[model samples]
Target: MFYDHADQQAEAMHPNPDWTTTPITPELIRGALDLETTQHGVLPHRLPARARAQCTDPQLAMVESQPSGVRLLFRTRATTVELDTLPTKRTYQGAPPRPDGVYDLLVDGRLTGQATVTGGNTVTIDMTTGTAEHQPGPPGTLSFTDLPDGIKDIEIWLPHNETTELIALRTDAPVAPMTDRGRKVWLHHGSSISHGSDAASPTNTWPALAAALGGVELINLGLAGSALLDPFTARAIRDTPADLISLKLGINLVNLDLMRLRAFTPAVHGFLDTIREGHPTTPLLVVSPILCPIHEDTPGPGAFDFSALAVGALRFRATGDPAERATGKLTLGVIREELSRIVRQRSADDPHLHYLDGRDLYGERDFAELPLPDELHPDAATHRRIGERFAELAFTTGGPFTGHNA
Candidate 1:
């Protein structure tokens, strides 16, 4: 997959590799396990006996399974490693504690072991008593005591949980070669709204959910408080190879008040131009932001929300002319119109370029039905709604996002 000049440079600098054929030597296997332990912050959930057996060509597979449906995988060899799971932080008002569940591990297609994550870790602060107390509970760990030699495959199974998440998978060994499977690649960039700010599960983030719904591999470049039209980011997009691509714009710029209308329009143009340099005909969808009342028509001073201060939570906000905003001066709606117009003009020569109103994903009607908790980021339910809408609008049959065909 060849991209434009910027993309070619990025590919050369950080080439994506195939990891399937990479031989899993003992050293490599140990390195993989160590990497997983360190980067993933948790041990591999399960490992079958065959995973411990020595083999010339070792591989790990994860097939959907149930009870809890937690899958597991293991590297061929093992070494002493410590794994830990981080607790989830409550980022929203009335957010509930995350649930915990069990995950199983399989080696070479057979169940080898399992570990339980008991979710009851509560440290209550009693203002009346002026004391903080810890509730003791069973800790979570998976240690394989005995094993046969010649291991080859590993898998992991995680039941539903609230407190812990499978943020990443890591291996100390070099990445294996790319598998010979056709996996759709998704490239997306956006604001903190896309960064899983108020989402419930790690996998429940809108982009993650949309990927699952569309069955595509994802490269999320969603940065918190930083989707402000950086040329480097556009260059990054230009350099990456993707079967499909989307850019969620507008709200971040309006909320940040990063640039005036004069600058915003040209920046948007330049951003799209840079991406086109690499992906001239890729199915590219540019989306505006969801409805945000405060910053809808107003510019922002980029201040943090003090409302949560009463509850001891810090939230970011964009400040601007409320009166002018009320008169419909500066809003995501305004930007959406401009962006659509730009796409329409540019698409005359670039038919592959497309535009979608953010309202299509979440409109004023929906906002009235399910309002955002912090006036900015959506709740978990809203994330699910947005993901489903995106998948339906962009990935379903006859949808706007036909990927390679588009």
Candidate 2:
């Protein structure tokens, strides 16, 4: 994914736009819970108010602002559209350079094109050196032209993994906020797997995929390395308007080794309680972590396999001791049991609460065919599998997320 930095910089520095620029407003954005106006441009935040205030951990701050499921939605008659943005690209010192974040264009709900903006900003992390550096680059423009003529709904899904600072939007035809298309809002919260970690594009993320299949508007709170049943995140989810809600729990807890089984239980319960406060009857589905054989029985603090990194690759291995489980440490297996029990106990009174074992989406046999490339996150194909599976299991009739699809 190495780019010709010199060539990209030259293009970024130049100013040539045939289309008229339009000021983007809040109404045109979707999937972002909150947005902050910055000197560079608008910075989208998946977490809002109290949730943001509670996030002091650098990893949480960094990933939540990456705009994983965020997209710009508007109506336009334009034959051409261009978006200028300053995107922060990550480069691991030892691993093969990652690809430039991808921008996907959808006209009237069908993907029409894709492009990558080059050379906006850079963040280099050296695990060996235990240091990170930020090298800022000029803003780059992603242009799509010669679209079908006539009034059309245009959605430009931002890169799910990049910290994109949107500078401006230009279109040949005047643009307006998308009309209320009357879609059920679906708010989904989960770990990096749900954040589209290795998915090829923003729209291809499982949640994005499932949402399209189920015909729901999505507000994805899939924060990488941060879905640890945080109270504020619960509150943020509680406050957001959603007809259907889902909380994908487990992996991040084990990976970070954040709590023992004793504490994890109450945290899950409490997290649900907060969300129930706002939408008591919302069909809330509790999804356990998808099967990661490595963390199924083993506890984590998952660590980057340094040996693999040395060979110019990236791979992860769970480092926590299995014996630690005896001390109430969390594991995917334990979390599933507890999450199911908790949901069952609550469902008697709160019929809206339901449970879905993640293994159903990616169990042992499925893993054999579609193993996690990083030994944790799913690859693009796996994302598609999980997304389709979710749509089948949760978005189908008789499923927790099904009734609200209308």
Candidate 3:
């Protein structure tokens, strides 16, 4: 049962005396590379300090702190759990408002309950101009009651799209960090699609769902609008420990119009080279962009569909001309071809390196059935489809991330 945060005053005035308060610490957090002590609370960060220091873009900073796959993991017998959090929500200036981010609770790996904190902060964005305004507010408490009995592992999956700061944790029973389960740690990097974009909840994100099905611990480095093959991100991935690794490249590169084929090929090569320095023989998969029709033949620097925006809906359209491909501009088609060629060339010497065309996960036929709502990010159902497909292709027998190989 979800205890609504509407009773914020009551919760604050009459704290449950039977509950035990637990301090938020690095040990209790999973999927976050670093935890920063903020004035309000400990904030989980997806990127390490070094990588964050290299970039000055406010968007990257905001997304990294959104904690796409980060969760609080502990073993407990608590039937009631309450978490105090300050969630920074986002709103588009003229587009339809987004719902508050969700917190998914899992007991023994099964999703048990879901809740959302009522109020905290809001970041209003002007999509057309690329500007944002922040409004700070007070924290809210999320409570979950009537949990199943007996000692079990519990995971409080944080909001994937909200910048949440942990303020406090209270439970009826004691809690301890969950011990390693011997599952292979799968580290993945991609664009916002992998960052849980448009997904209903944190655990529902494609990477999260895939990790659950594959029985692998996930460390998602899927930064929204920031997966441009940055050297710092590559270095972060290289230094992180993982039994298997995958990089889903292309979409963000095209949408951002960050580089041409000339710059992209060498950057991709350099990114792989950096990762190989640390994980020389680990099963590494290179995935190209999924089926995005707008950028299939047309180059990008994608723009908002202003017509849709007029109706209070958010949508995107490729703005660059297709003829630009003649000048070595990148289109999804160009990326897919080049990625395949690069992987095939490198695999001759690097037996562990592998490739999967992203279209195989969400292809033209799939797109026809479940078209992308925004011409880019997949919707919740699409996230599930992509996740299931990834597990089947990468974790089953004869796959690069098969038990024997990973």
Candidate 4:
């Protein structure tokens, strides 16, 4: 459905008398309908103001890795149609200024054109008028001409910038589909570790890397300080669709000292129950946390050891009573044991459910060889190592990944 700049111009000049009177039909709509697309941003949940400020690159500012193409659904009332692209999320310093120039245009998910703005003007394409203009302030609109005699879908690729905000999207069509069936989605939830806490590029995050490695789609639900078995998050997971799913647990639970054994057990169960509502038969993997010496077997009033920072290490201490430790209170090691037990119990009845000890992703041996930078999140090298190990363990056919046996 993409029109070249010249084609758009020619169509604009012709002024078909039937253009506005063309009949509309659903057959022309070409992308996914009733779907919601979201970005994990640079980090997971809880986007801090400072982190938002650092997203200066237009491409990296908003959503990353848009599916190759999407269908633009539209309705026709007049001789021509105009399309606009805007940012959905914004970072604030003071007042919002005009967006910068630079953008690509796509029709039916294919690159059909490009545009450059001057000052903060919007880019407009008028097919019937056979003219495209860059209007100052806000996003400009694109007009399409030469009525195809039905509803249509068009997609626009906007420049990425920290300041770019998705204000509005309009089309002559009645509906738009954002994704296609070819995209395989993998929904994942974990701690800040899964959120790209210390990863390098927006795309280099472990989930992104793993998705590339596995050649599948991804929906990362990792939250920063808020992975504490919240019902709302679990409900969000339950409502989303996925081809595969994973929950990296333990470390956050231990670090934050959210719950003890009794509560943690049922909390895990409820979380699984919620996800099962949406993905009843999809493959689901539950993982424990990687090794952190201070939180391994200890309970916590976890504190940042300033001395360790000087030496490029972090020391966390368990504040639980020694007696509590004996009884197996909240510690990474304890959480791992409980997670294993829970998975075993659940898997007996749910064939698609499985468990992966977080240690399998990164263990004592791996840590000893390359310790974490601040005793918490892994460094770039570790992210690569973890990503590789995850791909090997979870994605490879005939590997340890459950159901591959069949």
The candidate that wins on TM-score is 3
Scored against the true structure, residue 290 in model 2 reaches a CA lDDT of: 94
Error (Å) of candidate 4 at residue 322 is 4.9
TM-score of each predicted structure versus truth: 0.61, 0.96, 0.98, 0.58
Q: How well is each residue in 1-406 modelled by candidate 2, as lDDT tens digits?
A: 1122345444543434665677777898998888889898898888885677866887888899899889999998888777878899988997998998988899899999888888778989887776789998888777787899999999999999999988888777789898778999999999999999999999999999999999999999998999998888988988898999999999999998999988988888899999999999999999999989889989999889999988987889999889999999989999999999999999999999999999998899999998888898999999999999999999998898877898
Please say which candidate is ahead in TM-score: 1 or 2: 2
Higher-scoring candidate on lDDT, 2 or 3: 3
Question: By TM-score, how accurate is candidate 2?
Answer: 0.96
> Which ten contiguous residues of candidate 1 have the minimum total lDDT?
58-67
Best prediction by lDDT: 3
Arranged by lDDT, best first: 3, 2, 1, 4
Candidate closer to the true structure by TM-score (higher is better), 1 or 3: 3
What does candidate 3 score on TM? Answer: 0.98
Candidate 2: clashing pairs of residues: none
Off by over 4 Å in 2: 1-18
lDDT of 3 by residue, 8-39 (tens): 63465255887789899988999999999999
Question: In model 3, which regions exceed 4 Å deviation?
Answer: 9-14, 404-406
